[model samples]
Target: MDTGTHLVIGLGLAGLAYIDPVVAADPMVSTAVLIGTVAGSQAPDADTLLRLKGNAAYIKNHRGLSHSLPALVLWTALISGILWLVFPALPMWHITMWVFIAVAFHVFTDLFNAYGTQALRPISERWVSWNIIHIFDPVIFSSHVLAIFIWSVHLMRPEILFPILYAFLALYYIWRSWTHYRLESGLRPRDPTYEPGDRYTLIPTVHLHQWQIVKRKQDGSFQLGELRNRKINWIDRVSCAVHPAVEASKAHPNIACFLYFSSYACAELKEHAWGYEVRWADVRYRHRKQYPFVAVLLLDKKLNPIDSYVGWVSDSRLEKKLRMGGA
Candidate 1:
């Protein structure tokens, strides 16, 4: 989910807190909880500051450590404690409880999207993306916005409204998950060569009808496809064969980090003016105009490394950066 969605969700939770008569009776307690809700909702994303260091650190650690179990507790405590410091006269436990709810909700909702958090870190380093929902769903975000708009006009009581809104959103997730499963089942018969455990990575797009599918086969080949109307349209394919040039390119730091972060990565080795260019990217994000996360390593005619550009580069910027890096 985006930051705006998270912030609105925190506000929704604050509305729910009003259901409790004790919280509703005290304006100071209400202020402390609201403050906690706003800050705690964005605490995990503090890792975005890593962009200052460079894209390498940002891509590698974003949602990895920051969204883990220990980090969740740390964020809740730090944000809640800071609010307690500001309003020492207020009830500390009540502020921490609401703030913890906001922080926990932030981590919980991230699990449903394609770019997931490692919520069970230390227990598992595996990225647990359900791919059930788009990172920014119009339905989810708009519903929250609408509720806030209605509340501002004094149209209804938020305590009664938010629970119903959240309930509808839960049902929406179920409906989307069922649709995703049905569409993916249609792809299996198209390629009967798949064996058990060779499952396709099916991700939902903003458009309800469209889905991105990336499948890896046992024969060292991958297929990228789009699913619409229960039919798949092949977009691209790559072989996982170990070429000498591709093998040597992985020794570079940029290429190594890319492989670690990409869930369904594939590479293309192409001849270039200088020598060779090995391009690597994950098929999950291929729906974008320019692949958001990619690595390009250029090698000389002798197969020795020339230079490389890695991380998020748009179409127009990619060529210029590669040229600059190689020089």
Candidate 2:
């Protein structure tokens, strides 16, 4: 979810807090909890501050440690404590409780997207991406927006309205999950052509009925598809050669960082205007013929690296970057 959606959700949860009669009666406590919820909701994303240094560091740790279990406890305590200092009249326990809920909800929702979090880090560093929801979903964001609007108009009290809104949202997620499974099952290669490395993954788009699919086979062949009407329509196929990491390319910092973050990565060795280009791509995000999270290394005929890039860029920008050769 985007930052705006998360912040709106925080505000909606604050409205839901009015369910507590004590919160409804005490303006000071109500203010404190609402502030805590809004702040806590975005606290885990604090790792985005790393972008100031460069994209490599930012991509490496954006959701790695900041969204982990230990960090969850830390964010709750830190945000609650900060808010409590500013408004000392509020109950300390109340601030902590609401902040905890906001932070926990942020972590929970992130798992539904393809760019998941290492929520169980330290216990297990594995990434947990359910791939059920798009990174940005119109339905999810609009639901929260509508809740806030209704609350603003006082058409109904937030406490009553939020429960109804969230209940419907919960059911919607269940239906989407089922639909995702049906779509994936439809794409499975049921014929005798299934190879050991044959695998498929669906990437959600803005539309509920459409998805981008990437299929890989043991022979290093690739197929891209679009899912509509619960069926995959083949868009194109391309084969990429795979090789053991070339010593020079492997030694590059950008390549190391790209490999660490990519789930289904493939590298292509191609000729470039300068000499040669090594394009490392994560197929999971292959949509609209662009690979955003990629590492491009331009090398000379001797295989000596001339320049490199490790971050998101459009096809034109990537080509421009390679031509510049680290300039």
Candidate 3:
């Protein structure tokens, strides 16, 4: 989830039962306590995508442990242990109890979002990411943004209104997910040639409002289809990887960066005349390194052309250093 989006979620979860005078004064309650505690618990996942120093090992190892129950227990023990040893008089148990809850809540919310989160990692090797919501759904983001503004204005004042409003939003998603399912079920039967070993996908529904359907065909090709209001498959191939190759042929080092985030990346070269432009991202997070992008380009030493790239992140200093050093 985006940081801002997560922040709103974190605050809400932490303060859920602590808003009114009955809960506000308790060390275990209140918006301020909730925000910080939630941030700590949810903050670890951000590093899994190569944040901070941006090392691949950081990217690879971050989610494996941070989202686990053991990690939370250990975190709680350490906090309680330190507080008990240093400030024995403080309400240390409450601190530890709330800390553990905040951590668990963080992992729980991530489990429902699109980015693969390392939930149950040590105990379960499977990664988790809900395709039900877009990484940035306007409805989701706008709701959170609006909540943050309202809450910030009150400055953690004890009020029941925010919680009530948020409760309704939760129900809205339930209904939204229902519509998304209906939209998918209404689509035409998928041609199985692109599926894995003739196996069918649940026909993953992503970007709820956008209503994108990505399913594997019987032929092992991944087809990105749309079903928000209608069914449409614009790109059909073994994978989107080929599009990156086509994109590389017409890309410079800059658009190469663009390819990192383009949803429709393609690569190709011409005999001295070449062209490359993102055909899809005019509406989404353009120039943000991820979203509706089009074909990428690649060129060789003689500016001839070379292989295309796939499955890599752009703008990571650590990746840059590693590649340069490796080269």
Best TM-score among the predictions, by candidate number: 2
Predicted candidate 3 versus true structure: per-residue lDDT over 1-327, tens digit per residue: 556666666666555545535346665334334644665556556555654543324434555577676776765565456545655554555555665666675666566554456677577756665545655556666776666666668865425645765687789768766765666565545443333343222222334445555554444344454444454554433332334434434344434433333323333233322422222121122224333223223343344333232234343432332222212
Q: How far in Å is the alpha carbon of 49 misplaced in model 3?
A: 8.7
lDDT of 2 by residue, 1-327 (tens): 789888998998798778877677888888888988999899999999998988778877888899999998999989888887898777778668878989999998899889888899999978888888988889989999998998889999877998898899899999989988877876776324456767888878889988888788767767777887765577776666554334467678878777777666777777646577788877777646776778878778777778888888888777776655433
lDDT of 3 at 263: 29
Candidate 2 to truth, TM = 0.92
Clashing pairs in 1: none
For model 2, the superposed segments whose C-alpha errors exceed 4 Å read: 189-197, 243-247, 272-274, 323-327
Worst 10 residues of 2 by lDDT: 238-247
Local error of candidate 3 at residue 199 (angstroms): 6.1
Candidate-wise lDDT, in order: 0.80, 0.81, 0.49
Q: Rank the candidates by lDDT, best first.
A: 2, 1, 3
Candidate 1: 10-residue stretch with minimal lDDT: 283-292
Q: Which of candidates 1 and 2 reaches a greater TM-score?
A: 2
